[model samples]
Target: MACVYSMRSSLFWMMLVSLTGLAITGCATSVSTTTDKPRLAQQSVLSTLWMDRAGEYRALCHQAFNMAKLQVDRRLSYHRTLEKPLAVIVDIDETVLSNVPYFSQLIDKGEVFPRGWKVWMQMSTAQAIPGALEFLKYARFRGVEVFYISNRSINEGLTATINNLVKMDFPFADQRHLLLKSKSGNKQPRRDRVEQTHEVILLIGDNLNDFSLIFSDKPVVQRNNAVDMMSSEFGKRFIILPNPIYGDWEGALYDYQWGTSSAQKLKVRQQLYNQ
Candidate 1:
């Protein structure tokens, strides 16, 4: 009887050892698999705050639509006797669509602008901005035309942009209404074309360049002065949207030079902050 009990204890010990060995082997495999795997970092506090406050964002959209409606009404009233079609020029990204997801993807990857920006634009998955769809529909109902004046370089993605707009049910006419950046990155030619057929009553965008090509290449101080000059036009014939993600503001601060190395750019940015 004693011998039988000893044999059972030995078998139990053997099984315990085997299980422990398996567990260690499995853990080592897992560690090896995850050692060099990529992972996204956490978003910044500002981004988190903005994303968390859905109610505020909705209110902002409402305000934007109200402002747009007022401009549209004013334009229609002014062009009541004009033989030409009444139209409004609107910027696509940030002003008419939300590309937060694309930016968030970049943030997750611990990346910054330029490369990420190119990739985001290439994806062309930007959805309509909050209240933009409603405002466009309202304008359409009022017999006003909407033109998308984007700085997105003309390329294979142009078709994708149009298709995405259609999918989102935005009021888009064909290639005629979509103005892309020319080789010069100047928007005046496109604006000229729009003016030929339609009297532009209001211009809406998150950037000053959307309204006119004047400030497109201006320095920071000059740009501010230009904005001051046009301050009176804002909220009347111009509706500016809020965009904190990226803009010409960054360009001006960085000397409008894109060919500089990343380290040099970082140094310049740091110097600006120190000043």
Candidate 2:
């Protein structure tokens, strides 16, 4: 019965294609193709699953925040008489909140970024990452302020992002504490803004860009070289989380060329294998 139904569906699609002389979107679901968006979504399946299901992912998140807590404590003990109040600036997506589910939805639908991202943000359903809430709340209890500086658009994602954080009971979820992207994804300006009044003792994020604008727009080799140069700061002043699904690291592989075709991307990935 299943075989018969499959055959009938295939025949219907064939007839429709013949009549219209144009291929319908997603009509060849079973056929393997190097179509960019769907292929990229397929590539993300494993990373998304790891983030959503693996206990290791949770442990890594906890490990990051644990180190953050220790650093904050150490800084507080050493700098008791600082003029500016202490603050921890954190990135929002995948740092404070787990958007694994959003990526999962995109994977299921063979979609990618900036497609349903705004809609997902507006849903305000993102959950706090493991240990994020506890650590931020601890910071607040210790008289330190927490600031959210994210690349999420201020216009499209402000209200929903705040709502999501507030719903999750994140510390300092208000307008004054949250800073969204205005004209650029470079978060250095936002970090500078935070530094205007508060002593930013710690910077936490999944991406290096969250720490400094130096990591922004760099190619793969330069980015790696920058990381090596800044090795001492990784677990100390910077709390780095795990996010394998998507990042600038991936973008750097294509030399930050956003216009590359899907098939070309696949070729590049294949060429870079084991290199």
Candidate 3:
């Protein structure tokens, strides 16, 4: 479904307009201007997916998975992974299951997140990314253990997340394979947990933090530097699904402060874009 420009109410925009000269508030803001949508910080996120790029998005998924398949082949050819059960660590949202519906609802219905989020998950209708299921199943068929590590908290929507996964016919779709965030957002701990049993051949997600702590909780520039340092590993050991909507990339622009108002954040982003 197409998104219906779901930003906050008009009064909020007026208040933000009034704050044009106000310094950054107690709540941090992002340089990425998606806060209130002069279109989502990255307009391409919605426009590309909701418009002409639907096929391109699917093609990217297929290509990423294809690259992953080749990597798996390379690993199989190498004897190092044979010593332990092989596995791939993946993030749940956006990477495997597309959550564009919730995003669309926000734009169309003007309903904010954590409001209709649970209801959306409860519906259990998140379609799998174009090539995710096939690649995951292929990994399973080759005896690779798949671990789904997501920041979707247990207290928030874990049950429905699991149900959605199982409903979508994802392999290893059970409590054993599904992991919801409990302790921290740092997925390295969960990756370590998986590595305790199997060699994690690949770490997949739409966010940079999904792969390593280097990108976790860091500033925007630092995260980019870390990505540059590990450039060689991206396609080979870390498969990143495209998610221009929201992630650490956007969060970093706000300096990781969660309390920033949409209006304030948008102002900050606008400044960045103008620069």
Best by lDDT: 2
lDDT of each prediction vs. the true structure? 0.75, 0.89, 0.79
Q: What is the overall TM-score of model 1 with all chains considered together?
A: 0.77
lDDT of 1 by residue, 1-275 (tens): 99999999999999999999999976544332221212212323365347435677667767877898987887676565548888888888888878778767655665555446666666657777788999999999999899998888767457777877887899964687898776766777888889999988888888888888778878899999999998898888878877766678767876788554444455566678798
Model 1 lDDT, full chain set: 0.75
lDDT sort, best first = 2, 3, 1
CA lDDT of 62 in candidate 2?
Answer: 95
Give the per-residue lDDT of model 2 (tens digit) for 1-275: 99999999999999987876535533423233646678878998888889989999999999999999999899888776648999999999999999988898888888778679888899999999999999999999999999999989999999999999999999899999989988987888888988999999999999999887778999888999999999999999988999998888888998988766666677788779957
The clash count of every prediction, one per candidate, is 1, 0, 6
Stretches off by above 4 angstroms in model 1 are 1-54, 116-124
Q: Which portions of model 2 miss their true places by more than 4 Å?
A: 1-34
List per-candidate RMSD values in Å. Answer: 13.6, 9.2, 11.2
Instruction: Look at candidate 3 and give me any clashing residue pairs.
Output: 6-107, 29-254, 30-253, 30-254, 31-269, 34-41
* Candidate with more favorable, higher lDDT: 1 or 2: 2
The 10-residue segment with the lowest total lDDT in model 3: 1-10
**Candidate 3 lDDT, tens digit per residue, 32-78?**
33345434424434543552247877788889999998888888887
